[model samples]
Target: MSERLLHLGHEVVALVRPEAAEVVGAYEGRIGDLLDPRTLTAAVTPDIDAVIDVATPLGDQAADAAAIAALTAPLVGTGRGFVYTSGVWVLGATEDRTADEQSPVDAIEIVRYRPAIERQVLALADEAVRATVIRPGLIYGHGGGIPALLVDLARKFGAPRIVGDLGVRWPMVYIEDLAELYVRVVTNASAGTLWHGVAHPAVAVKDLAAAAGAVAGVTTEPVVWPVTEAADELGAPFAAALALDQSVSGAAARDQLGWRPDGPNPIVEMLDGSYR
Candidate 1:
């Protein structure tokens, strides 16, 4: 995201820990830590044109709320843009239905606090801040993210293993595509609006596992790892999230912000592109 912003002629300032200062490269690096709310006070200064809260602080909701308060207090009534990053897990299992931006949330246990945080961020629009919430699906690309975990599992077991039932599906977005949506929202979106950053809305987990197996040089048919056992290995909340079945739409982003996700197919990318 920083690179994209810089390539577009926008100045980039990254908030990082002291150890990561050198990693910011051409962008200015502000010393801070998301897990420590007090350190985030200097993240948004008067010269900052916009603020994007993409940091997820290890499920520490209190720290996240405090950090948000500190970041936005300086921008109140300034009409500056504030983008908060959330995830589709807040929508929970959509079952056979496809959820849009306006869908009523049936958030699961893991993200129960997210709805309140999203509401807090959206309410800032009334304070003259152009606050918007972006909910991205399972972000995958560059041989990273949750998909890579499946590849790891395939290598570990010498066979592909999927969590929960075979019918489970996930919403997906390429990393670069999701980043482009962030750029659009930062420069173009109206106040108080929400956007879904998904591309492929219903990717089957079995297919993903098979691709992962192929990547691991194993063509064995994927097996279902029960959610209970998965929880033992991957934590209860995240395992439940992996087991969720959801379909989400990014139409609002396309129709409103003119976002074009021209990325390669996720499964194909895993099989023959980045993940390879």
Candidate 2:
């Protein structure tokens, strides 16, 4: 996102921890840490036109809120924008249904912590800041994402394992496309808007694995592993995610932001080795 913004001629200031300075220094932006309120205050001055919070892990929600509050407190009603990053995981699992922005979040037990953070960020819309939330699906592409992991697993295990029916559908987006959406939302979206950053309609897990196997030059059938057994093998967190069956639509973002996704679908690209 920072790269996209800079490409668009916007002066970007990114927040990073001290430990990440060496890596983040390669990017053309200011680096600071969210945990330190003073660092944020010094980085985001009143002259700044907008604030985009793309910090991750969701566990840093409190510090994010505090940083946003501190930055926007005096600038309220000044029309400065505040864009917060969220995830589609808050929508949780759906039964044979596709979720939209208004869909109620029935997040899996492991990810229930997301809704509270979403709510807190959404509430900022009422505080006179031009705030918007962007919820992105499983982000892939640029050689390292979920699909790549599957390809790696196929190479390691000699076959891509499929848990259960393997028909479960998951929504996904390429990192570049998602980055474009984030740039649009931060720059042009109105206050209180919610956008889904999905690109592909939906891809079946089994098909995705098959494509990954093809990319790795391996020919094998789906190895059906029971949910519990898969959980034991892949660990609870990852296995729980694989068990979820949910898809999301990016129509809203495309309609509102004039955003278009041109990136390759994970499965197709995986098979063609374009994603590697």
Candidate 3:
């Protein structure tokens, strides 16, 4: 997202820990800690036009809320843009049906606290801040997301494996495509609006595992590892979330912000592209 912003002539300033000051090299870096909200007030100075909260306070809901309050306190009545990142897990299982931006949130245990924070960010729109909430789907690409974890499992177990039933499906978005959506939302989306950053609404887990198996040079059929067994390795909450069946649409972003997500198909990308 920073790369795209820089390409479009937007100045980027990243809030970082003191030790990681060099990470933001050419771009301006302001030292702050999400866990310690006191250091954050300086980040949203009057010169800053927009603030994007993409940092997760691990699973610490209280810290996240506090960090948000500190960041937006400086922007109230300024009408500056503020974008908060949330995820589709908050929508819970959609089975075979597709959920849009307005779907009622039935958040799973893993992200039960996120909807409240999302609401907190939206309420700021009433305070004259252009606050928007974005819910991105299972992010895949750059050879580094959840899909890559499956590839590692395939190589380790000598075959592809999915957390639960092979029939389960996941909403997906390529990293670069999701980044472009952020550019649109930060620059043009209206206050209090919500956007779903999904590309493929429902990609079957069976197909995804097969792609991972192919990447591992395994020709055998993919395995459906039971959720209980997966929970032992990947904590219970996350295991349940990975096994969730969701079909989410990104139409709001496409129709409202003219977002065009043309990234490579995820299965193909895993088998022969970035993940390979």
Give one clash count per candidate, in the order shown: 0, 0, 0
Q: Model 1, poorest ten-residue lDDT window?
A: 55-64
TM-score of each: 0.97, 0.89, 0.98
Query: Which TM-score value belongs to model 2?
Result: 0.89
Q: What lDDT tens digits, residue by residue, belong to model 2 across residues 162-267?
A: 6655777778998999999988988889988888989975778888888877877779976665778877878776777776777888999888789999988677
List per-prediction Cα lDDT, in the order shown: 0.91, 0.76, 0.92
Off-target runs (Cα >4 Å) in candidate 1 are none
For residues 125-164, write the lDDT of model 1, one tens digit per residue.
Answer: 9899999999999999999998899999999998899888
Pairs clashing within candidate 1: none
Best by lDDT, which number?
Answer: 3
lDDT of 3 by residue, 20-96 (tens): 99888789999999877888987788889999989864688888899999999998999999999999999999975
Which prediction has more favorable lDDT, 1 or 2? Answer: 1
